[model samples]
Structure formats: structure tokens, C-alpha cells
Target: MAKDNSFDIVSKVDLQEVVNAVNQAVREIETRFDFKDSKSKISFDGKSEITLVSDDDFKLRNVVDILESKLVKRGVNLKALRYGKIEPAAGNTVRQNVTLVQGIEQDIAKKIVKAVKDSKIKVQATIQGDQIRVSGKNRDDLQNVIKLIKEMDLNIPVEFVNFRTF
Candidate 1:
């Protein structure tokens, strides 16, 4: 009897890394002359949201750019961020909220399953809560599925984990 080989695909972000990135961005903003006196700020809620406030839209954009660079340096995928619309804040500052993506959305998981089925690969792809499990008797087929998924432009960063060959 050939036991199945399997792997799980999930989209996740490390909140600690996000906090570090936000802290780095804040430090940089404080040192930069353009933002020295300009009310530019980045605040993280220690969970899934980061808020940016600046003197105006231009400064706000600069703050976002800095924060993005810091995040990238921390190996955090830019796709994990969902930018909110800029709006007025207290004291006439422009504020924007950036939501950190934490899991594979249902629609995206369905899309992944559909893609796997359309490929006609001899593997089973199933949505398991906020992740997807792919299993097959042949390990090569599993590898092929991984390659196929890597080729997909899913607009979110995915990681493969819990690979098991039984």
C-alpha cells in the first residue's frame, strides 16, 4: 500500500517582524530631515493593523514608502499589506491604515483549488480552513503541483509546510 505524500499551503505574516519593521521605519522617519518637524508617524497595533499619519498626503506617501522598504528588508512580502484610503486625522494630518494579511482568504483558496484541478495533476487539493492541503501517492506529482502553484500570480505570498511522505 502506497501512503500519500502531502503538503500544506498557507499565507501568513509574522506580527513580530511587522512590529520590528514599523519600529525601524519610525526611527528612520525621526532622523530624516524632511520628517524631522513634520508630524510623520507610524503606529502598529501589535496585531494586524498599522497606521500612518503625516502632515499631508505627500509626506504620508513618503512615510508609506519608508515603511514598505523596511518591511521588505525584514523579508515581509509587500503583498501582505492592504492599503486603506487616506483620510484626515486630528490636527489636519493625513492618515492611512494598512491591514496585515494573516491567512488565505476563502476566494483565493477556491482559486488555488480550481487551478490545481484544471492542471489535471494526479493530486488532490482541498481547502482546509485557512489553508490548502495537497496530497498524492507519487511524490513527483506533489512536486509538480508545487511548481505549478509557484508559477501562479496569486497576489499573496504563500509558504509550503508540513510536507509528509508516508
Candidate 2:
């Protein structure tokens, strides 16, 4: 029996790395001269959300830019940061919530499958829960599929895992 070469595509972010980045951003925010008396603050809930509070719109933008740079330095994709509505908080402050993307959604998985199919590549793409599995007889075809998917501009970060040939 000829076995297939297969690999899995998954969207996963290292929360620990994000936490470290958040910590770094907080430190920078606290010590920066511009923020010395601006009452700027950044907080992470240790899960999948972050909150940014600043005295006004200008400081808020600065804080967001700082956090984004830290996240990119930590290897987190900038697209993974989804910003919520910037609303006014109590005591003359502006607040914004940032949501961290964690996994591949079903819609994205479907899109991957569609792209693979559309490319006329000789591979099978299956949506296995939160991940997509691609398998084919030709390893080269599988490699091509990976390349094609990477070229697509999906809104989340994806990782290729469990590459196996049997």
C-alpha cells in the first residue's frame, strides 16, 4: 500500500510570548518621557485580550504603536492583533481593547481548502476541526500547496505541522 505525504495547517499563537511582549510594552510605556505624566497604561488579562488606557487620543495611538512593535519583535504577526472600538472610559480617559487571535476558524479553513482546490494542485485538503490537513501522493505537490497557501493573505498566522510520509 502506498502511503500519502501529509501535513497539517494550524493557526496558533504562543500566549507566553505575547505575555512577555505585553510586559515589555508596559515597561516602555511607564518609562517613556512622553508618558511620564500621561497616565498611560497597558494590561493583559492573561488569556486572549489586552486593554489599553491613555489620557487622550494621541497617547492612545502611541501606546498601540509601541505594543505592536513589541509584538512584531516577539514574532507575533501584526494581523493577529484585532482592535476593538476605541471608547471613552471614566475619569477623562480613552480605552481600547485588543483581542489576540488564537486558532484557525472554520471560515478560514474553508478558504484554504478552496484555494487548494482552485489552484488545480494534486492534493487533498480536509478541514479537521480547527486545522486543515493536506495530503497527496507527490511530496512536491504538497510542497506546492504549502507555497500557494503561504502566498494567500489570510488575516491570521498559520503554522505547518505534523509532516509525515508513510
Candidate 3:
């Protein structure tokens, strides 16, 4: 009898890094000449959403760029920041939503399931909550799944953890 091997694949973000990036963006907005006294502001609404308010679309875009730069500096992937459509608000203002997506979205999770099924690998894949777990009889098969996942560009950062030999 041989032991089974298993691992979980997940996409997660470091909240602290996100906070650091936001802080840096605030400092830049204050010092940058273009944004100085521009009446534009950046704030984190709730815990996972970032709201950017500006008088015009151009200035709003600039602020978004500044925030993106900070996120990059903090080693957070740009794809993880999902931006909503810009809309008009009262007092002649424009607002946009920046959602910090920490876990696997529905679409991405489905894609992972489909890819695993199409691979024809002899591993069992189950979606547990927000993540997918893969298990198989051979260690080599599990490693192969990991390699296959790495080869695909899912546009999300995936981490492998809790590997165990049953």
C-alpha cells in the first residue's frame, strides 16, 4: 500500500502590504505638485474597498496611477486590484472603486476547475470554500499538477500549501 499526497492552491493578499501602499500613496498625493491643493482625496472605505474622489477624470486617473505605483513597490500584483467603472457623483465629482480582491473569484475558480479536468490527470480536485484541493496516489502526479498550474497565466497569484502525504 502507498500513501496519497495532496495540496491546496489558493490566491491571497497581504493586508498589511496593502495598507503600506495606501499610506505611501497618501504621502505622494500631498507632495506631488499636480495633486497639491487639487481637492482630490483617497480613502479606504470599509476594510477591503478603496475610494478615490477627484474633480475631474484626468486627476482621478493620476491618483489611480500613483496608488498602482505604490502597490507595485509593495510587491502586490496589479491584477489583484479590480477597478470599478467611474461614475458621476454629486457636487460635480467623479468616483471610482478599487476593490482589493484577496481570494479566488468565481470565474478564476471555475477556470481552475476546468483546467484541472481537462488535464486528464489522475488527481481529485475539489473546491473547498474559496480554494481548490488536489489529491492523488502518487507524489509525482501532485507535483505535475503544480507544474501545469504554474505554466498557465491565471492572472492571479497562487500559492501551494499544506502539502501532506497520506
Candidate 4:
């Protein structure tokens, strides 16, 4: 049997980077002239969630923008953030929750597999847990699969990992 080349497609976020981004955002808000007297706050909830509170919807949006920019600077994908609706808090403030996505969901994994199958690149893709593994008889075919996947414009961010030729 011919050796197969393979790689795993996974969607993951580094929690430490997220924490750093949140902290940077908080620091900026603290020093920014416009936010001096406002009640804007950003914090991490549990392991993979962020809670943001602000005096109003406008400030909340600004806070989100700051956090997103920081995340981008840290090389974190903005698509990994799943945000909840802005709601009124007890002190007449607005609060929002942003959930960090750490892995690909089953539907997304299936979509990845389907995309690879339809690319006509002579590769077999299978969903393994929260990721998709693509394997082919030629290393070039595997590389083509990666390129094709990048061009598919999927909603989530994907990382190519565990590339093996055997």
C-alpha cells in the first residue's frame, strides 16, 4: 500500500492570549479620557467566557471594539468570539457575555469534511472528535486540500496541524 499524507484541521483558541487581550482592553479603558467617569468593565468568566459591562450600549460597543482589536493584535481570530445580546443590568448599565470557542463543533466538522470531499482533490476527509483529518496518497494532494479549505471562506478559523507522511 502507498504511504498517505495527512493533516488535521482544528479550530482552537489560546485562553491565555484571550486573557491578555481582555486585560489590555481594560487598561485602555482605564486610561482613556472618554471612559474616565464611566463604568465600563471587562472580565473573564470561568475559563472560556468574557463578561463586559458598560454604562450604555454605545460604551459597550466601544469596549467590544477595543477587545477585538487587542485580540487581533494577539493573533486570535475574532470569529472565535460568540457574543450574547446586550442587556440591562441592575445599576442601569448594559452587560454582555462573550463566549470563547475552543473547538470545532460537530456541524462545523461535518461541513469541513463535506467541503474537502467536494473539492475534487483526491482526498478522504473524516471527522475525528472536534476536528477533521484529511488524508491522500500524495503529499501534494494534501497541500492542495489545505489551500482549498482556506479558500472555502468558512465561518470559523481553521489551523492545519499534525501533518504526517506515512
On lDDT, the leading prediction is 1
Tens digits of per-residue lDDT for model 3, 1-166: 9877899998887888888888899888989888776877788754689988888999999999999999899998887778999999778889998887777777888888789889998998888888989999988889989998989888878888899997
lDDT of each: 0.94, 0.92, 0.86, 0.89
Expressed as tens digits, the lDDT of each residue in 5-101 for candidate 4 is: 8889999998888888889999999999999999999999658889999999999999999999999999999988899999999789999999888
TM-score of each: 0.98, 0.96, 0.89, 0.95
| TM-score, prediction 3 | 0.89
lDDT of 1 at 143: 91
lDDT accuracy of residue 125 in candidate 4: 95
Q: Order the candidates by lDDT, highest first — what do you get?
A: 1, 2, 4, 3
- The better candidate by TM-score, 2 or 3, is 2
Candidates' RMSD to native? 0.8, 1.1, 1.8, 1.2
- The most accurate candidate by TM-score is 1
* Model 2, CA-based lDDT: 0.92
Cα RMSD of predicted structure 2: 1.1
Clashes of each: 0, 0, 0, 0
List pairs with backbone clashes in candidate 1. Answer: none
